[model samples]
Target chain A: MTTLSNTQELPNGPVAAALLAGGAGAAMLGLATTLAEASAGVKNLLVWFNPVGPLSGKTGVAVITFFASWIVMHLIFRGKNVNFARATAVALTLLFIGLMGTFPPFFELFVKE
Target chain B: MSISPREGWTVLHGMLFGAAFLLAFAGGFAGLYSLRPEWVTAEGIKERILRLKVGLWAMALIAWATVISGTYIVYPWYRASDATSARSILLADPATAAWHTFGMEWKEHVGWLAPIAATVVAFAVTYYGPALAKKVGERRALMIFFVAAFATASIAGMFGAFINKVAPIR
Candidate 1:
């Protein structure tokens, strides 16, 4: 209990279980984010009905950078605690703001292009 | 793009967003309490339970009051019966006109959807809530919350439809 071979110490029964579950949740969330990213079609789908030409436009450049960072850290660096959180946060922030932009033009257009 | 008054998509998405957070929170609470009961030092789960309850209440109040209120002020567009606003909108210039038309359509869809979304979210809370509570040994309270959630949501859904028809948010 006292001595740890690694940086994270070995935990007791319920503590260990809790930690494991939290870790699993974080990982699954990361995986889900990754899957959403992998499908590239979603971006196109948004702009499809949109009067806007592209999903990212100027803001989209930001999204790509976030996605790139997220992928490098999670898939490549393999889920270091801070890295995973940071990467996912970047991707999410960009993605959410990016999606919100669609409303202005789409809401204006009575029908589609 | 005739935005149906029931924009099930956006409302459903928002509800799901709230639901997902609720579940994750519940799961964290139950799992944490079950394993590490010591971490909860203060007047613990009571506050947490109250937080969840308050969340739903706040959502319901805003949803009915603001969303539907806004809808009624602009109800002429959604209801063909109320052609006054509709004709005015038709008279606007091209771009502004487009926004009025589509924005109004989006408003209609989002209007019908909000309460239904709330109801679904409530049902989710009830189901997942009890399940989480049962996992942590608070089976009785969990059941009560779950049942209340479902019942409240069902009523909300029914009322939402009725309100939209009677008042008709444009």
Candidate 2:
């Protein structure tokens, strides 16, 4: 073990941005998955690519949400500190929603007969 | 023995890219776990940080590659509407229908989370660099993200393997 006398401190904003954005992206995917099951319109709308079917749109929306949210949050919080703990909690909640949304047993509940 | 084009792509996506990400997880996890100011000297951190960055970035990239290839290439074949398609074969029989309904459904969506989470972890680590060692809370959060990435990938890879065994995409 070694002790360091000097360690530079950087703002936590960027990390917070990443965490939040990741969660947002994941939540979006889950939302898309569940919605696709709930409505035929959503399922068809998500079919961005023919071969890949609705998966293309589902993932496309997620990728877009992740990057877009990241950029927006980064710009707002750049070089600044925020409540890291709060950010983490929110992100985790979003992630949980994402996980549940993707699970077939869970999403299938929304399926229309 | 020679393999068909579809088989070759399947091998490349699952065996090459997916396996590489899974295999690298141990090293990355260990590095992240041990990345503490008390655990290593300043000089030691410099060395470990470089290796960690490289490994994390590689894992992230490989994850992206795996999903993209799986989604755009192999998935089309597996999900084709033809009677011989993997999805059709699985759905054609009640015994195997659950593989598509449950296994494949969870795998495809959850698999995507791995790359997204991984990229976030990679970016955070690179952004923080050696300073990450001192920030205990931040480091812990990153570890959670890393573990999440690994867990999601494992689910996808496992189901992918099982699904292929049950009904290959050929």
Which candidate comes out best when scored by TM-score? 2
For model 2 the local lDDT of residue B166 reads 96
Report the C-alpha lDDT of model 2 over B72-94, residue by residue, as the tens digit: 99999999988999999999999
Native-referenced DockQ of model 2: 0.69
DockQ of candidates 1 onward, in order?
Answer: 0.02, 0.69
Interface RMSD of each: 14.8, 2.0
- Candidate 1's residue-wise lDDT over B107-159, tens digit each? 33323323323332332333333222223332222233333223333333443
Against the reference, the lDDT scores of all candidates come to 0.34, 0.93
Colliding pairs, model 1: A56-A60, B5-B108, B5-B109, B7-B109, B71-B169, B72-B169, B74-B170, B75-B170
- Best model number under lDDT: 2
True contacts kept of each: 0.00, 0.74
